[model samples]
Target chain A: MKRYFQNKSLLNLVFTFLGGVLLLFIIAPLAGMYLNTSFNSVHNAVGSEEVQASVWLSLWTSMAGTILFSFFAIPLAYLLARKNFPFKSLVNGIVDIPIIIPHSAAGIAVLGIITRDSFLGRAGELFGIKFVGNPAGIILAMAFVSIPFLINAARDGFAAVPERLEKIALTLDASPTRVFFTISLPLAWRSILSGFILMWARGMSEFGAVIIIAYNPKTAPVLIFERFTSYGLKYSVPVAVVFVTVCLIIFVTLRLIKKKN
Target chain B: MLVVDNISLKAGNFELKNINFRVDKGDYFVILGISGVGKSLLLESIAGLTKISSGEIILRGRKISDEKIQRRNISIVYQDADLFPHLTVFENIAYPLHSRKEKNIKEKVLTAAEQTGIADKLERIPETLSGGEYQRVALARSLASGNDIFLLDEPLSSLDSKSKNELRVLLRKLNRNGITIIHVTHDYEEAVSLANKIGIMEKGEIVHVASPEEIFKHPKSEFVAQFIGIKNFLRGELKALRESDLKEFSIDGIKIFSLTDAGDGEAFLLIQPDEISISNSVESGSARNHFKGKITDIARAKIGIEVTVDIGCELISLISIDAMNSLELKIGKEVWINFKASSCKIYN
Candidate 1:
């Protein structure tokens, strides 16, 4: 067994086998789909009204959700990291609720609040802003399920900042608020940015909640689902492939930026 | 002047009670204590880092109990070299000055860096600096802010002996320049060497507070005597008592005298390690009490060598290196160990 294992020939054979298997997992499906796909079909998919609207809606809603979630999550994360409060564990548990619940159930739960009968919908009606089938509902759905990643990640980031640094800042005559901005936030920013990127990617990929509340606006995920249902695999696969590749590029770039940070 | 009047704080498992002391303008008050004795907590309480349960911290004639830490004008240098890693060495030292938006911040930072000998590492980040350099930057950052009342919590703890001595000298210089320093450390020698007033803390309370001379010469309690490493403590009854301001006593047929004016009751004799002497013969000298004992052990200490001579009933005397050599001392050698009555303290 030692002689067999020590054989360099056997090691090369193992590498060849493993590399082929890995390449099959990563590259085979994309190659198979693209081989089957035609330039004319790609053009048609790109030109379609529903596909274009779906792509635009996905962009706007995810961007808006990411921005809003980051704005709210950063401070709350800092608070959870740095301060002592009553019912802290309870607050932490509550913050983790969205991440724990199934995405479909999370979507359903959000749908329950934004539907016409709910309090938020009632409040929105007073302001002449509807939620159901609206872009706002799509954004609300994306933000609801995806925000926990940002919050939790940002919390870890903020928690990593040594409290001594903050106290030192305070001793330096920086006010508490000033200290947070100058010392705490900057120190915790790498984690916060990673959280932000995770949230953005999660928001962009949101399907269940958007389908539940704003299926009419048709984010890319719902559109892909609808196209698959109506026109079978042949018609839908190319669009799905295009949508995924675009998102993959974006998500990877975001991750790289997070890594750099 | 910084006056901590009866500060008592109970945080988690650690309790600090009745911590009363004062540091006048330009005074370097070093608090010495063991781990978990609330030395850092006390410093924090004074700095407004930890909230005081009940106390008045009057700094520079201002009662800053409820005041925010930023407004208190008390800077702290923690043990961990708590420099902001994101900020460069210059930026870290410049932090306080920048926060106040003070004019001449760059000049102040440069000056501080120069003083701490970290001027060349200004542009370099904190993580790049060595432990000694990091602490020097921390100290520079602390001092550059213009807060004369500096709360240094083991600033030299991270540094080696050489660095510690250099920083100690720098701290002494700082004090001489009218910076009132409250330096907290677990090192007894540092407190003895650097502090104008040393507060010996045990179990959160300052058990003894005195000048270095007074504390070393006459520690009031057993804990202090033990803490300060005074090795000549023995349980004894005052056999015969002298009623003068400086009294006398005896133990176990070995007559001894103490400066403490205690009655003929239970007393513990206290003597510094340096005060005990060993002689080959009964030499007539300034020392009052002489006891015949066998040399038990010899060990080298920082200041001098300690000679432990066993006087049958477990009485020990710690003598100097010169004294040890002068007597040509070795283990199991019978000798006359003389520790004067005036030198020994009887604490009741």
Candidate 2:
């Protein structure tokens, strides 16, 4: 080991040092946030009914949004990967628009379609559900802001699969639909699942969009903001710590499962 | 039986024009061409993977040009195998069965695996298999579909020589089991070994189609002759017509005889390297044509030595290394090259 490093040039040492600094820059803030909070505050925050409800709302609504949106997003991804049509690049650019634009602007875009006067809002009213200040509105806002991750990731996954494999499947008497579901989808599942986790996490942490669309049924991010404004950092820091800890545990477990498979 | 009738297709900037062919049932038809010559495109168009601009593909007496790929009951194996990475070998082979909703899936999959000698690796995935094993699994998958027509696009090109030989035997075995095959390959040896009928494609056109023996021995075009490794192409004009369908031609004032009944006009003559024999002495028997030339070049061929003799024009001959040693053949050495009249093929 000593000889290995001794053979390195000074330029290599400088590059290594810069990369180490970037790694530390990412880890330091999260480590500081977790270490500064006391265990008693984290425990008390977890036990609070309103905090528990907000965490539950964030978890289920984001999961619901990801699951519901995947049906459409995955097929669109397959089409983008396999087909050649007019305005294809425009459609691809439109998929990325949600990711690049501000979350507040995304929220307003969802608002225009779901407002009471619009046809979609009237349709929701016919189903006895109001979008303004409701869980439905929150789910819609979460899905709107986070769906591009799923689409782009799944599209890349499908693109990586060999076109000949799908053609071979079709020649083997499998229909195009069967070929997609059996061959393309299963091969691309790893990317699709990672996309699912990313979209779900992004929805869980969404603040500006959820605040604009629905504020009554407070998600974890909205509740944390409300606590910071109403009380001091003393009240908000515990909730933030609790939410971050839970997210860390869940994300690590998911990544471990992904690795095992 | 299958027929590709007057097929014309435009793919990007490449255009295949008026391609026509027929493959009888149980025939191992090989399309031989160099790369970028629309061989794979032709196979894909036949399997309905690529659309043809104007054509009718007939299979078993029915026109199938407009049919969907799934309804065509044709199976193709690509060069890379293209096996599904997510599935185990068993699942990959059994995939078509699931699509067909067939009964006895286990029995069918096992039969195909056993036939391809891959039954032991059924539980493994494609990523873990060797190149030969991956191709065997792909072949098993195609065979499991119970399709009669098998289209292979350079399937053995990626394997090592030992593996390629093994798969070649396996493909021959599959052909013996009553499967009509349309194989596309750039390797002349593969085409000669597997094909009963060979089609030579050049620049997106089927330039010549004939039996393997006829193609190698009597190429009708200069391209076919050169592509098949026939090194001696002498452009000559017909000078006389002898009895028993024999004709004489002269090239650069040197006369040659060919056993063809072609008319008295401009003609091209082709002679394969193996058809010529080299002798140290000028004593020749039944061979009708003989020329004394000095050895100009000698190179190591795949099987033996390739000797180029200059008899006004360069003529190549393949002789065994032992023969070379016995004759003590060397550069600037004078030797006699003898060939029969039937050996020289003439085309007008």
Candidate 3:
């Protein structure tokens, strides 16, 4: 018992010492940025209409991407998790490609599909929808890079649901649609919600892809980049601090809601 | 009545070959087999949850092979209950009613819940319920559907003895209410107790289908005999008695008479342990076969003490604990084993 306690204490001490370094490494920079910036500067940055519009546009585009992509991603996640087909492993591997590849490459790939002269681009023209330099383009880029998170998480969620429940539901006279809606979807809702929040956060913080796709719409990250490049670090720090604080508040609130459920 | 007529299905690599059975209306039919014998797969195919590769399922004289599960009007309850975790007990029971858009959902749900003895658990979630209660909710849910046939896949396994007994009673009551049941399990005791007729499956094929007593007394094949755990599977030869129609069986020079109609030739003899009686001395028991053998072993069985006697061949007899003490049965004690001619089964 003495040896066991000694070993456990030593292991815990080493883990705590190592973990604190990484924790401090993350916190110190953010804390430094916040401490160096005066309250007046942050308040002024919040007051600016351009900053307000940029933050609002960022939230709007990310939320749009998260919701719209989820419709396609969720069912596909279910398929990925449940069905066995030819090249199933190949298809599963492809879902994570966006997460593995660089964001700029994903942006360019997405552009290839939506740009003028492409088949989808001309098809969109028939519907009077523009993709380039538009909020639509921003959503496309954001969703493209961040969709893997939703797909992976939702797949795990759907996989965790017992197939026997669905089978039993079907025998109880529930149609396939009713089973999907009432049984599979509700059981997988939590992981889907967590994935939703992660996708939104990742999409909003995206810069490289959004820059290549829709630089003019000026999402909060794009505005921060512009401020830094144009007026140096002094002008960008306050906006960065304020934007991060907003993201944290919203993310924490969403997490708490999920926990309650 | 439901008839699974020559259904052949290949689920992955495991194939059920030309499965055929008839479940009469209001009959409690049980398919007994070890795990992975495609019992659940067969049940799934009958419910239309699994599409048979080639075959027809006829129900009430109408072919339902091409019908979807929702239109089949069959309900199944699994071993672990599989209750919807997000839904309250009431909603879980009401699910089927909601699905088919029935107008009298609340009344049906309440009645079904009350019938399954889970009326007070209507407001609780599935996660909070005990294993027995969870199963009761699943039963209540299926009952609310008002289906003519219900499939139970090992509903009594993984339950405490008390819970198992309660579920068995509930299952008997369900069958009594005019619902045709096709239950699947590996437990022969459960099969014999609850099933009016039992089908024995091995390697995805129904080897035999008969009443529990018939299946136990006269197994059709060596596999069936062994699978049912028949202790005495002795090979013997039968010859006609000179004066009577009864046959005399000879096993290694030991003669035992039986009333089986199987022809006078090589045959297998099955003497159920419980059919054989034990006594300290010879008595006018009127048994056709009596052997004075030394007690080889005594083991505790679920029903009673299993006293193994070695005459020429070893034969086991199940006797009550009271009988065991009265007779002073112990290893190496001399005992007389007596079984009537009708009790011995002969299979060619």
Q: What is the per-residue lDDT of model 1 for residues A1-261, given as tens digits with 9 covering 90 to 100?
A: 778767977889999999999999998888888888888887888888878778878877888998976888888888899889999999899998988888788888998998789999999999998988998888899999889899999999989888877887898889888898998889888888888778888888888878888778788899888888998888887787777777788888877877776
What stretches of model 2 exceed 4 Å from their correct place?
Answer: A1-11, B231-277, B280-348
Candidate 3 structure quality by residue, lDDT tens digits, A126-222: 9987888889899999999899999999999999998888888888888888899999999898999989999999999999888898888799999
Measured over the true interface residues after superposition, the C-alpha RMSD of each candidate is 0.9, 0.9, 1.1
Q: How far off is residue B96 in model 2, in Å?
A: 1.4
Give the per-residue Cα lDDT of candidate 1 at B187: 83
> Scoring model 1 with DockQ, what do you get?
0.59
Give the Å error, residue B134, model 3: 2.3
The DockQ value obtained for model 2 is: 0.63
The best-first sequence of candidates by lDDT reads 2, 3, 1
Q: lDDT of each model, Cα atoms only? A: 0.82, 0.90, 0.89
Worst 10 residues of 1 chain B by lDDT: B239-248
Residue pairs of candidate 2 with colliding backbone atoms: none
Per-residue error for B267 in candidate 2, Å, reads 31
Q: TM-score for all predictions?
A: 0.76, 0.81, 0.79
User: Model 3 over residues B26-65: C-alpha lDDT tens digits?
Assistant: 8999999999999999998888878899878999998999
The alpha-carbon deviation from the true structure for residue B280 of candidate 1, after best TM-score superposition, in angstroms, is: 4.1
